[model samples]
Target: MDYHLYPLGDQGVLIELGEDINLKVHERVKSVSAHLEKMNWDWVIEYVPAFASVAIHYDPMKVMEKEGDSSLYAYEIVCAYVEKELEKITPSHSEAPRTVEIPVCYGGEFGPDLAYVAESNDISEEKVIDLHVGGDYLVYMIGFAPGFPYIGGMPEEIATPRRKEPRLQISAGSVGIAGKQTGVYPIETPGGWQLIGQTPKALFRPENEIPSLLQAGDKINFKPITREEFDAYKEEEK
Candidate 1:
């Protein structure tokens, strides 16, 4: 349970579980997050889990009242409590990661930059798709846009840089690659990732209890589908 605590402004504490973004670090992050969820801390507002850190946002007023110490600042009080709680957590206690299947239809209209990605990697378009599908991926975090998953573990062979000019509007479920990472645009938004395919599945469902289709620490499997299959999947949704 090696970690460092940093003051996030005055009301939040950033708990650094590890320095690098690896499975080991991710486990610690998840473990800490799960532990926090089980605890009934009245002063805790919310907790955000990231690549190697978990940020806990708390209520300064509540912390001051709970501590009943005029000498100790709110931040100091919260940090001490967090540090003690973190000491009790171990990676082994973390729940097993969930595996999610993301079916993608590569190339053609769905992927405008498919050719570019293939050329840049010096491989055929089909090979590019094969490499992408073959690789195991993990949802590192959801960010940039609602339900957008920042996935990692892309095969190095198919790795390519983001486009110099970003597209004004990328349709939701458009799968793209940026550098060594891959992600799906959850909402229609402007982005620079190289579009390689699109998924008929909806990643963002605001009406649901959990809005994001994916979350941090989930395992991802990319399954390739044909144009006909993609259209059929879309039809089923409606």
Candidate 2:
């Protein structure tokens, strides 16, 4: 219930709901964001919600114009309104998270770090795949790469830390794990997470109405597929 509001340069206001990254904090973050989006306040230009905070971008000129008392600053006006509004917002739990299934071809050439991950965990490659697929992860936020999801809910049994050395280039659709999190690489980019599999589905497409396949508050499940099936899925996309 405790929160803090801070200004970001001249255009953005960041709301910190809690100090730690947890489900309860995210719930508060999402609630505030949902309320902000609905209000569509004249000064608010955009909303960027993360695990424990939400950044609200606004027009400084518009905010200043609306405040009749020139003595009141832009950030002050925004902070007051946000604090008052948030006090009345009751977090909604009616909505069930949308689940998306991703098909992955594990090990071999597709996942260069698969062996390392298995050995590090003292588990067989098949067991590693099982643990990865068994998770029902929640999409906490999207960043790092376009449509790159930072997901949570991986079992502790399979938790693996990030690689000491990052790869110069990782292929799109590559699935990787770091610490207690798992995510898919939306595009070819340098990364340090341990690669476990690759998915054929495009996580980000500029032409699509919804450019990012995943969104915050959604859930994901990994499905293990054969190497041949992976090839077929890739071909079908063409």
What does each candidate score in C-alpha RMSD?
A: 1.3, 1.5
lDDT of 1 by residue, 60-159 (tens): 9998887785688999888888888888977873366899999999999999999999999999999999999998888877777888887888999988
Cα lDDT tens digits, model 2, 145-216, are: 789888988887778899999999999999988988888999999989899889999999889987999988
TM-score of each: 0.96, 0.94
- Number of clashing residue pairs, candidate 1: 0
Error of 1 at 157 (Å): 0.7
Per-residue error (Å), model 2, residue 51: 0.9
Report, for every candidate in turn, its global Cα lDDT versus the true structure: 0.90, 0.88
Model 2 lDDT, full chain set = 0.88
Q: Find the candidate with the highest TM-score and give its number.
A: 1
